[model samples]
Target: MTRTELQTLPERAVELLGGEPDDTTLRRYLHGLAGVDAVGLGQRAADLGTRSIKTTSKAWALDRIIELIDLTTLEGADTPGKVRSLVAKALNPDASDPTCPRVAAVCVYGDMVPHAVAALGAAHGDPDDGGVSVAAVATAFPSGRASLAIKLADTAEAVAAGADEIDMVIDRGAFLAGRYGQVFDQIAQVKQACRRADGSYASLKVILETGELTTYDNVKRASWLAILAGGDFIKTSTGKVQPAATLPVTLLMLEVVRDWHAATGEKIGVKPAGGIRTSKDAIKYLVTVAETVGEEWLQPHLFRFGASSLLNDVLLQRQKLRTGHYTGADYVTID
Candidate 1:
C-alpha cells in the first residue's frame, strides 16, 4: 500500500502466477544466461539507441512504437478502405514489412465494430492477410459525459456486437471534483457490464482522458485507481481533445503500470491516444515501455495506439523501401 511496499514485488510474487516459476528462479536463470541481465535490462534502454547518421534508418524507438500501434483512427462505414490502408501501413512500417512486427490492434468507434470485425475476418480467410484486432471505443466516448445506465448499455452493445476490446472514457468532471469513489465505482460497474452470461467479454480499457485530469500526480492517481477498479487498460485520451495523449503523461502512466504490476502482480495495459502521427512519435512510446515496464508489455494485449493518421506515414516509409521510390504521399487526412 505504501511506496516501499509497492516498489517491492508482491509477497506472493511467484504464487501470483499460479504454477509458474518464482522470481528467484527467473533471476538465477537470467543471471546465468549470456547477454542477459536479470536486473540491468530495463535500466539500460537508450534514447533512440543513437540517432542514425544515415538519416535513412528508422529510429529504434519508432520501430518499437510501430510494433505497438492499435491503428484505430477509424470511423464510419465508408472508411473501411482507410482501415485497409492503415493495415497495409502497419504491415509495412518499413520496406513492405519485410520483417516488421505487427501493430498492437486497430481501434474504432463502437458503431464501426461490425465493419472492422468483418474486414479482419475477411483478411483471416486469405493466406497472405496480416492479422490485427478491432478495439471499439464505447460508453459515449469523448464524454463520459453521460448517465451510468446509458454507459453500461453502450458497453454491453459494443461487446455483443463483436468488439474484441472496448475503450471507455471516464467522467473527468467527477474525478476532478474529487469524486474518486464515483469515478472508481463507475469503471468497476462498466467493466462488469461488459461481460456476458457466457462468461466471455471484450477486454475493458478505461480512458482517463489524462489531459482533462491536468496534473502528473492526478495522472498517477488515476492510473492506480483504474487498475484497482479492474481496468484491463488505462488510456490517455479520446483523441477528441486538443492535448490528447502526450509523452510526459504516457511516461507517468507507464511508471504506474510498472508499479502496479510489481505490487499486485496484475499487468494492466496502457494506451496513448490522440496527436501521435508519425513513426518517430510511435517509437518514443516503445522506448517508454522498454525503459519503464520492460519488454514484456510491448505485446498488443498490453500496449496500444489510437491514431488513424500515423499508419499512412508508417506505410509510406515501407513502400519507399520496397520500390526504391519514396514518392508516396500521405494516405489519410483527419476527419
Candidate 2:
C-alpha cells in the first residue's frame, strides 16, 4: 500500500478494537481466525531456514541483525553500572568498527529506566533518527501477575523516567482461562498509561510469552488481540520461558501481522526473544519475516530480537566477514 493509504494511528489515539471489547466480541473475533496448520507451518519455517544466502547477502544480514537487536539486561542483580555498560555497547556495538550501526534500543527493567536514560543521554531518542531507545519491561514482566493499579503505576513510572518504549507482558493466565476481554482491557489500559505528559505515548510492545500459550492458534489470536488493543508490537517471550521464540511461533505471529496490515492498512511489529543466539538462526527469522510479511517489516520499529548473547554471535560473524577468517569466541565481549 502507498504511504497515504497506510492508516497509522496517533500514539495517544483510542484502541484499534472497532467493536465492543466485551468477552463475547473478543471470543468470537479470536476464535474466528483461521486455525493454524501446525504441520504446514513448521514445514514452511524449516523450508525457509534451508534457503541460504550469498556471501554478500550474509554480510548485509549480519548488519541488519545488529540494528534489530534490543541490547537487553534484565536480572535481579542488574545495576546502574550494568546498564551503563549495556548502553556503551549499544552505542558502539563493534568498538573496532566505527561504522558499525547502533542497536535499536537498550531494554531494561522499569526500575532501571532512569539509569538507562541517563547513560543514553543525547543518544536516547527515536531509532529512526540514529538514536537508541530505552525500553523498560513493565506490567509485572515475565509473570504478569500483578494488580491493574500496580501495573499502571509501573508503566507510568517508566514513562516518567524517560523510557521511550514499554515492553509489557500480557496476563497469560487470563488469556488461557478464556478471559480474553480481561487481557484486552489490560493491554489497552497499559497503552493509555504509556502516554507522557505532553500526550505522546511510549511505544508499547505486548509480550505473548508464546511458550505458555500451548498452541499456534493461540499465538495467532494473541498477535491479533495485541494489535487490536493498540500494541505497537507483538513479542514472543519475556526471555524467562524455556521455549522462548521458536521459528514456527514467530512465523505464525508474522502471518497475523501481515494479515492485519492487509485488512486494516496498518503495520505492527514483531519480536522473538530468547534462545536465538546465532547469526544463522537469526537469518532464518529474517528470511521468514521477508517472505511472510514483506521486506518493509525489517526496520527496528517493525521487528526486533530480544536477546543478549545474540549480539555477541552477530558481532563475531561480522568480524569474520570483514577479515575473511574465523573469529574466536573471545573476539566479542561477554554479555
Candidate 3:
C-alpha cells in the first residue's frame, strides 16, 4: 500500500477510538487499556513452557524453528566477509545434513544489504529463489534517534539495494514522551518509504524495544499502535537492550496480535528477538505461540526468531535428532 492509500489513517484512528483523539484523547485511550496481571501472565508462560514435546514432536519443532529464524548479524564490526559467511550459513544451515531447512532470512545492517544480496546470488545462483530473504535494519536501527529524513533515506537505500524486508525501529523517546502522533506518523512514513520503485513494497518490521517501554501496559499500547500504523510485524526488541525478548513480554505481544486479528481481520506477524540462545528456549516460545495464538501461526511468515547464535544451537539439535547423538560445536558453522 502507498502513502496516498493511508492518508485517512487519522480518520481511521478517530473511528477506532470512537472520536477524534487529541494527545489527551490518545493518552486516555492508552490509559483506558486494561492493566496486565504480571503474576498471572508469568505463571501462564511458565506453565506452557513445561508442556513436553517428545522426540518426534521435537524433531518437527527443530525443523520449524530453523525456518522461523531470521539468522541475524547486526554488530558494529560487521564486514562483507562476515555477511557472506552468514549468508552461506543461512542458505545451508547444516552443510553435512541436507535435510535441514534453510533459514527464513538473513538480517543485517542497512549498509550490508548489497553485500548480502551479492553473497546470496553467488551462493544460490538466484537471489530470489525464496530460499532466504535479506532483511536490513533501518530508521537509525537500535536507536531511532535520527531525523525522519535520515531514517527514510536509510530505509530507501536498503530497499534500493534489494533488501526484501526492512526492520525499522520506533522512536522510543517520542513514544515515552507521550507524543503518540509523532510515533504513529514516523511509522506511517517509514512504511511509505518501504515502497519500492516497482510498486511492490518491502515488508516492514517495527521494533518496539519493549524492554525500554518499562511496563506491560506500554508494550500493549505499542503493539496496537504499530499494527494500526502499518507494521507488518511487531517486534519485541532490537537485541541491544539488556533484557531483550523475555517470555512474558512476548506472550503479551502475542495476545495483542491475536486480539487485533480478531477485531480487524488483519493478521500481523510477531518476532521475539534477542537473548534467545538455546533450542529449548526457542521451543518454549513455540509452545507459547501454539497455545496463545494457535497452530496457524506456526509458519515462518507469521513468526520469527531474531538471533545469531540461536541458529547454531538449533542446527546442533537437528544434527542430534538426525544422527542420534549430540554433535560438537565444530560440526555446525558459526554465524
Top lDDT hit: 2
Computed on alpha carbons, the lDDT of every model, listed in order, comes to 0.65, 0.86, 0.84
lDDT tens digits, residues 40-109, model 2? 9999999877664433266678888999999999999999999999999999998899989999999999
Query: TM-scores of all models?
Result: 0.72, 0.92, 0.90
The per-prediction tally of clashing pairs is 4, 0, 0
Candidate 3 per-residue lDDT over residues 106-193, each given as its tens digit: 9999999999999988443222344688899999988998999999999999999998889999999989999987888788899989
Q: Ten-residue segment with the worst summed lDDT in candidate 1?
A: 326-335
Per-residue lDDT of 148 in model 1: 94
Runs of candidate 3 exceeding 4 Å displacement: 1-11, 19-22, 52-56, 122-130, 326-335
lDDT tens readout by residue for model 1, 153-247 = 98888787777688888888877776666776688778877776677556788998887777666777677667656678889998887689877
Model 2 misplacement above 4 A: 1-18, 52-56, 326-335
Q: 2 or 3, which is superior by TM-score?
A: 2
